[model samples]
Target: MLSVYVDLALGLTVSFLLLSLLVSGLNEAVVRLLSIRSKFLWAYLRDTMDGSDAQGRSWLPANPGEVFAALPFTRDPRPQHSDQPSPAQPGELPEREDKAEDAMVKLLYQRVQEIDHPKSGRTSIANIPPGRFAVALMELAASEPDGVEGFLGKLRSMGSPLYGHLKGVWETAQRDLDRFRQGVETWFDGEMQRLSMLYKRYVKWVVAVLGLLVTLVFTMDGLEYAKTLLRDNALRASVTAVAGAGPGAYEELKARCGGDDPVRCVTETLSQPALVTMVDHALVSVSFPAEGDPVVRWNGGAWWDRITTPSHWPGFLLTYVALLFGAPFWWDVLRRVTGLRSRR
Candidate 1:
């Protein structure tokens, strides 16, 4: 009884680990092809810099002339005008509006563009160090005619909440340039941390969708695999033997996955023509729909029923839920389970 349970557990773990690798590889490829990380970062920075004031005034320049004047670091010297009704002069100041914010937006974009490497035909800054952000702000401040004080003057002109936060930081830094830059860096770090969380939250939905698709494409029904392992002693023993073959075999398997970088590994592995053929025979033909759960067949019921029997949805759901734990998670689980099996 103990041996049966151990073999079942080992077989299930091995199967899950293989399926996870496939899902993770495909996901990495998708992320790269779409340039999701860079796009998300660009969006966060744009929204943060361009958020409106409480009085409904935009942080972007209301005037095209002012926008052009603020573009000191931009590649193109020519003005890029939008369709706003009115254009304000650079020197014009409103009692309620902040002209300096226009400059800040321009400067922020300049920084983003400086680091914006193109991926999949889209340009965006994938990552920016907090130190670099702090440095950029300080440079903007130093460019003012009155230096830091003039910069503070611009901050004071703004009615936005960002100004209030900067006011606190400036006071805390005692008007010292180095200390102020450090404070800015700290502020940027906090914002990046929040952005990181948001990025992960959004990406999880994409991951879940991909996981479900992979589960269906391969028909990786966890419940079905478990049942098979329970019934087929030879299959269970074969899977368990492969897993317990020691660290050398495991390392060799990972090496075939394209070195250490997850993205490259996944892309390289899946791009191979041999992988499709290998998938048919690998893991006892689990991925071959014809050999397992025939996705299309003629049955006496409805077409949908023939394509997908009602009994398979539960297994598909189980596989998808397990995949959400991700490849790294399953890799660790495989290692631990194999180690335990070896010890016993």
Candidate 2:
């Protein structure tokens, strides 16, 4: 009975781990594909005009995208070199610009053509040096004919709004432009880092939510499935026998999942029909409401069925929490559980 219990529980656990791994990898890929963090920062920095102020006064410049475009902190596109290249035809014009593969890089390059490589004299800036963007903004602020106070006024006129805290900083560094610039850069760096962290947290949330939906769709609730094993003697005997052989199969499953590349790991592991059969066979053993269980209904059914079913909330809640443990964690858990069988 204990071995039977372990067999099904471990299978369900591995299934959730596999699904969670899928979710995590997709989250990482989608966040990069969408360039979520960079897009958020770009939108924040646009500083486009808002028509009415609290004082009901029309802010001077209605837009500031052009104002930002004139700044010198962005990177230019770099040319790619092919492994093998043929000489151009005698009259063939040399290629000019290669489109950037990264949207964020392309966006930055488009803005900084004039100042990308100030020393390079109108050539596109190959890359924005680290710490350059904030530094350039600070330099621009300090170089205004008036001090920080006056430069901020110009920004407000050009549609950039100021925070009270930033407005307050000018007084402390009133005597030293360099001090003011450093403070501004430090503040900007901190804010950008915060935004980056927030974006990462958002990606994690996406993975968790997606994992939840997947578990539900697949009916992978752990608690209910375990109960099925307990109630069905024939199914339990079959799974326990399968579980006896699971250690060898699990070793292979571990190797496939342990590969360096996540997509490759999932693809390779999923291709193993025997391993997949273990999970699918375990799922087949689950008892159902031949009567009217909402867990059986993918669509609208009864809210009461979900709430009243002893296994519903507990099973789903268990699976949901299991997903949060992540694939590596559960893979290790599976290893430990299998280790127990080996000891016997």
Candidate 3:
């Protein structure tokens, strides 16, 4: 019993350990894959933006003429001016030119003020209202020789450092993801192999247990058979006759008793030495009538039928306990093997 308990405990411990390893490996693989995906997304977005610093650093010139020169020719066709209109040249200014110059100066001043007081809620070319920044960049790109294609080529050649940083992270993460996936697959395969091995082992154990149970059941039947034989008066009479007891001795004993009723049968059976010896032999050989009973006589049933009756609760309980303890490990092994087969 102690050996059986130890074997069961060992089997359960191994099964739990295998399950834990498989779960932990799968969890790590999932986390690594998610991390790789996140890095990939970040790299893609950074590449798309061309690494323009997201901190709102101003790149445009403070001078109006510089701003005008930077704007596409289609938007600002006038020649750039170096200095403010002089008093002597005031009369040279056309009404439309003066208004255009005032608008340009005001736009430049607003841009400069936004740069100086960045904390103040304001917008720049990068954060142009609504879809205007997109339109402006598109216009600038289009004004170039190869339009957006040329701009993209330059951006790629320049190699945005942000993309490099993100790429490094992504590559590292991807390698880890691949390794984790391989490990998980390997772990899963190993678990399946272990389960297969354990299943075969469990089946062997089950067969042995079943054989023991069958043997115990048959032994109990044999014990009941011997008990029945001891209780048979005809058999006992023949034995007594062979032992030189007179023929009338057996016949007169039965007649005096008027037949075998419980009380009279016991009294007559106890009086015969040969019958007592035969009963003792059967009791000793069968080792039945256990400790509590110490004596068992036939009750008009076959050995198997009597053994299976309510009196055999101890044997039944023991068999049930063995099955209960062994079944879970057996079931887990079966389930794992089935899963492996389905995957294959």
Predicted candidate 2 versus true structure: per-residue lDDT over 79-124, tens digit per residue: 1222222222111111223211232222233434334332223322
lDDT of 3: 0.36
lDDT of 1: 0.58
Candidate 3 residue lDDT tens string, 286-322 = 3243257445554334545534577654544443344
The digit string of per-residue lDDT tens for model 1 on 57-93 reads 4323334333323321222121122223222222322
Residue pairs with colliding backbones in model 3 are: none
Candidate 2 off by > 4 Å: 1-15, 47-130, 147-149, 163-166, 224-275, 278-314, 325-344
TM-score: model 1 vs. ground truth: 0.63
Best by lDDT: 1
TM-score-better candidate, 1 vs 2: 1
Measured on C-alpha atoms, candidate 2 has an lDDT of 0.48
Top-TM-score candidate index:
1
Worst 10 residues of 2 by lDDT: 86-95
- Candidate 3 wrongly placed segments (more than 4 Å): 1-185, 193-216, 219-302, 319-344
TM-score of each: 0.63, 0.47, 0.18
